[model samples]
Structures are given as structure tokens and as C-alpha cells.
Target chain A: MKKTKKVRQEELKKTIEDSPFITDEELAKRFGVSIQTIRLDRMEMSIPELRERIKSVATQEWNETVKALPIEEVIGEVVDLELDERAISILDIKPEHVFSRNNIARGHHLFAQANSLAVAVINDELALTARSSIQFSRQVKLGERVVAKAAVKGEDERGQTIVQVQSFVENEEVFSGTFHMYRSNQ
Target chain B: MKKTKKVRQEELKKTIEDSPFITDEELAKRFGVSIQTIRLDRMEMSIPELRERIKSVATQEWNETVKALPIEEVIGEVVDLELDERAISILDIKPEHVFSRNNIARGHHLFAQANSLAVAVINDELALTARSSIQFSRQVKLGERVVAKAAVKGEDERGQTIVQVQSFVENEEVFSGTFHMYRSNQ
Candidate 1:
């Protein structure tokens, strides 16, 4: 039985959404189609490759308002962001992020994601850190996904923009930070 | 000419201060003495070995009050601590801490040291981080020593202890934070 292109594309979209990390080769094998056909279907459906798919979900138009760190250089993938207001990012802990013995993700990686997200939220051409206070509530182990949310809380006496970020692994809060950012414009 | 014991000890202390990272082997070569002699002189003057000296210069007693994480587990070496009031820690970035291509130390290593020091400060059995605000003033590179100082501020309305931490690399400030901590007693 031959599945039509319309049905195949819809099924492909559903499969990719269910497992965003699934590779093209695996998708081709599952669908019983040539790899070239899978690639063509993905292109026609406006779906990105595996790498981009992981970063593209739940994300706003990222490049326009973000001006601080280059998108590639940002610690985590920015999923949602609004200039001078709020932002959100997600990081998946990989083997490189953990201690070889404990498999616990290093604390600094959590901080970097939170810190970088805060900076991107209020980003000017350059945003220097003035100060911050943070706490690690729980340790994130390898394979945990950390979602960091940043909110701009008014200004301090020095006119530094205060951005607060909280990171969660599932429903549990793992880390949180409040950043005093010195924006080039502000 | 053989140097007197007093002169040798004085020069050794001065040398260690001038270059905190200088090894005893180097010092032995400079003074034309055995490594044992250099060790004896350092002990006589109450000067710690090269590793300890780097952390001990501006520190208070460390082992007494810290209760959050084990002493060895603390990210940076806790140099000065006065449990609940203030604490200080130092970390020297090595090869493992930096990006292989750039030698730029990961932001999380700095944050880990700062976060651990803050946790150790209140440290009543266990202290959880409720929130924090932070800023990174500069990028820390491999081989740079970071000195982190944590000060416990007053409690917030919710009874969370507010702690501020600032990390410096030499005379330049690299990172700072104001941490809101949920202490067990509070």
C-alpha cells in the first residue's frame, strides 16, 4: 500500500514532534522511504534539520530583539524572549557538562544559562554584569533539561537593569539568579 | 656564602608573597637549598605550602563552620569564613576548566565557586538558594585565580537571608551576586 504525500508529511511532522532528536536516517527507515524523499518532504513541510528542530520549538523570532551575545554563543537555546521585559531559554545537560564520576551537571553551566538569558532579555549592543546573587536549590544531573526564565525587575540605585532568572528541571526549581546588568543604552 | 636561617626564612616568605603560585621546587632552586629545607622554613614561619598559600593569604579559618557541602566538595577553596557573616574562597582555573579552542574559563566554574561560598556562609545543616541576582563583569581565562567574597545581608520580608557575593580576578572584579538564601533555621 502506497501512502500519499499528504499523509506522509503529516505523519512525519507528528513523528518529529514526538521525538525531536530522531535523526533523518531513522525517520527514513521508519517511513520506508528513500532518504532523499524524507529530506524533500522535510523541506516541503518547512521543517528544519534535526539540529535546528531541537532549538526551534517554542521559540519566538530570536534574532531580531536579541542583541547581546550571538545566538550561537548564547549558553542555552532562547525559546521565548521580549526585549527589556522577559525571556526564556532551555538547556539539555550533556556528557560534557557533568563530572565524569557523579554525572551531576556542574553548577556553573546552570549559572551560565541563567546569566546569559538575563543578559539577552535586556540586551543592548553590550551588557556588562554589575553584580548578581544566586542560589542553587538542587543539583541537576546529566540528562535533565533546564528551563530558565528571566524577568526584568525595575532598576537599582545605579540604574542597572535588574533581571531575575529561575531555572527548573521539570517542576522542581534547580537554580535561580538575579542579575544587575549594565546595558550600553541604559 | 651560606645564608643564615633567619635571612632564608624571611626571603622565602617574601618570595612566596610576591609570587603566590611559585612552587617549592622553584624556590629550592633559587635559594640553592634542598626542597626539604624550603619546606622546613615555610613551616617554621607558619606559611602554608604553595597550594595553601594561594588560598590562605587573605582568608580566615575555613573548616569550622561550613555545613552545606563537604570542604573538599566546595567548588573553590574556602579561604576566609566567619559562618553567617562573611566567607571567602579562591579558585585557580586550570586546563580542565577552559574551552580547548579559546582557553576561556566556563562561566559556571566561577558561579559554582561563588554559589558554594554563599551556601557555606549561612550553612545551618543545609541552606537552599531561594534566588539571586548576578553580573559577570569580565571573562575569566585559564590560569586566573578568582577570589570570591560572600557577605550575609539582612533577612528579607519572607525571612530569607540575603547574601551578596563578589568575585575578583586580581584587582579587577569579574563577577558579583546578591543571593537570597533559605536557611534551615530561618
Candidate 2:
């Protein structure tokens, strides 16, 4: 049976809220409606396009984990963070991040993902790196999504914190780093 | 006495070649000519605008330091590089690099600049960061220009190469890092 317009719109809104990155085409396919209908429904509901939704989510969720620095300063999107414990961020490599000659991602992009996560996990208001050791296990290509996880190991005698960050693409480790951090109190 | 158009144009070309980041306003002031005249001379000489010129120089100079990894992977424009010795890069913080509310640059951008410079200074094609220690000395604002310098310290007993990278904004140190790099041979 064909659902009513109100019911369909409500469902569409729910779907988008659940998965902000879903495309209109995917929504249409899922709803058994045309792409135009999906777009119209989105417009009627005052919902933004996928890109705008992603940006909004990025900004809205940013304040939760970041205290020492603004959310925008984190290299990637911080999806989860527990200060002085653990944190996670996701970086989507775009065309601008790759070499035109080869669709490979720049190594710094990976490093940024891990480095920023390390900084975001610190509990203090001022967190900085005193030293770090990193390894790139593999080359990350363009369009790949790198998920970096940072875990706070412990504190040294000097009160500097140690954080371990590992970045993975499709569950494959691409980069890993151990950072010794300095805080204001420390 | 004022110089001829031909002589002035020749000198303008030399000045830009020496310092690619000079602005049109600065160029006009230096040449005692109108900005329009400087633009016209640049057009006639097929010289690009400041941004394009910077990008061009970055791509051209990138190959000089980067061999193992592609030049596109470097975060900032590599102005100078001496493999396994010293290197320098410049990063201009853009709007996208900062949080929307505050124009302060994200921490990752600084890290990327320093980390990439560290990677580029490695002589080997398969150089990777085995460990790193970094510090954010000050908060970097958007539109600020960061100049990062990387110098090789020495090698450890484990054969890991050490590189020190320091980033400055207007002669003020903003970020610094020490990287332990691993090459394929070592």
C-alpha cells in the first residue's frame, strides 16, 4: 500500500536523522520513490542536502570532546572522545587531498588525523606534544576513510601524559603514533 | 629618473621570481607604478596571480625534496628542502582550516605542516615516522602564515633517523615536533 505523504515525510526525516550521510538517490531507492520526490520531501521538511547535513553534524558534535582547543581544530571529525582516556576521529580523504597524477592520499593527512586525536583526548585546557613516534603501515589512497583511535596510556614521572594513536582504513592499520603530551598543570 | 616600461617590466619579473609571495600592492609600491600597471605587466609576461604562483612554485619545488612519497602528500608548499639534512615549508591557514565561530586554526593543520616537513627531509623513498613528539606553543589564527623548518639531528642506535621540525608564525614559534623516522634500509 502507498503510504500517505505525511507518513512518508516523517519516515524520510527519521531515516536522514539516523544516517546523515545517506544520499537522495539512496533514500529514493529505499523509499520506492523518485529522486525528485525525495528532494521535494527534503525541501518541504526544511532539511538540507547531504553536504550541509554532514557539515552541521560536524559542527554540532564538535563541542562534546574538545575542551583544550576548539572543535574545528581537531584534524578529523571527533565521533567519540573520553578525556584522558580514549578518543576516535574519522577523516574522509577528498580529491583535493590526493595527487592528480596518482589517487593516493598525502601522508600528512593521515598524520593529521592521528595527531589531532591525540591532542583532543587530553583532559587539560592546554595540551601539547612533547614528542611522538609514528609508523605508516600502508599507503592510503584517495576516497579512503581513515578512522583514528587514541588511547591515553598513562603519565610519566614528569607529569607528561602518553597517548597512543592508531589510524586505520577499512580496519587496516595505515598509521600509528605514540605521543608524549605536556599539559598546563604538568 | 623613472625607468622605461621594458626595463621596469624586466625588473618586476625578477622581483616576483625571487619572492613569489609578494602582493600586487607591494609590487606596485616597489615599482612606483599603479597596481593596474603591475597587473598588466604580469599579464603580458604570462605570470599567474599570487596564489597560482605559490601553487606552481610548490609543485615545482616539491620534487626536489620528496622522492619516496609523492610531492602532493606534503601539507604545505615546500620552499626549500635538503634531503636528510634540512627542509622548509609554508602553510597559509584558510577559512576551512579553522572553526566557524573563531578564526583560530585547528591543531592538526600545524601538525600536518611539521609532520610532512619531517617526512620530506628523509633521504629514503620509504621513510616513515616511527615516533614523534610535538608541542603547540601558541594558538594559530586563521589567515596566518606558518613557516616550518625541519632539520636532521642524528641517528639513534636502532638506526632510526631523527628530524626536528619547528613552525613559526611571523617569527613566533607556534608548533614544534621531533620525529623518529624509519627507512626501509634502516
Which one wins on lDDT? 2
> Each candidate's TM vs. the true structure?
0.54, 0.53
For model 1, residues B1-186, the per-residue Cα lDDT tens digits are: 899999988988898888775677778999999999998898888888755765565455455757765577678887778888888787989987664545766566777888778878885865666666666788888888787888998899999988899887754688887777776798
What residue runs in model 1 are displaced by over 4 Å at the alpha carbon?
Answer: A1-88, A92-109, A118-128, A132-145, A149-186, B1-65, B80-82, B95-106, B135-139, B153-157
Runs of candidate 2 with Cα error greater than 4 angstroms are A1-85, A91-105, A118-145, A152-164, A168-174, A178-186, B1-65, B69-72, B184-186
- Per-residue lDDT tens digits for candidate 1, residues A1-186, read 889999999999999888765668778999999999999999999989865764564356655567776566678888777888888788999997775546777666787898778877875866656677777788788987887889999999989998888887754688877788877787
Local accuracy of candidate 2 as per-residue lDDT tens digits, B38-129: 99999999999876765565433544547656777788988777688788888999998775545767666787788778878888877766
| i-RMSD per candidate, Å | 4.5, 3.8
Q: Relative to the unseen true structure, what is the C-alpha lDDT of residue A87 in candidate 2, on a scale of 0 to 100? A: 80
lDDT of 2 at B101: 49
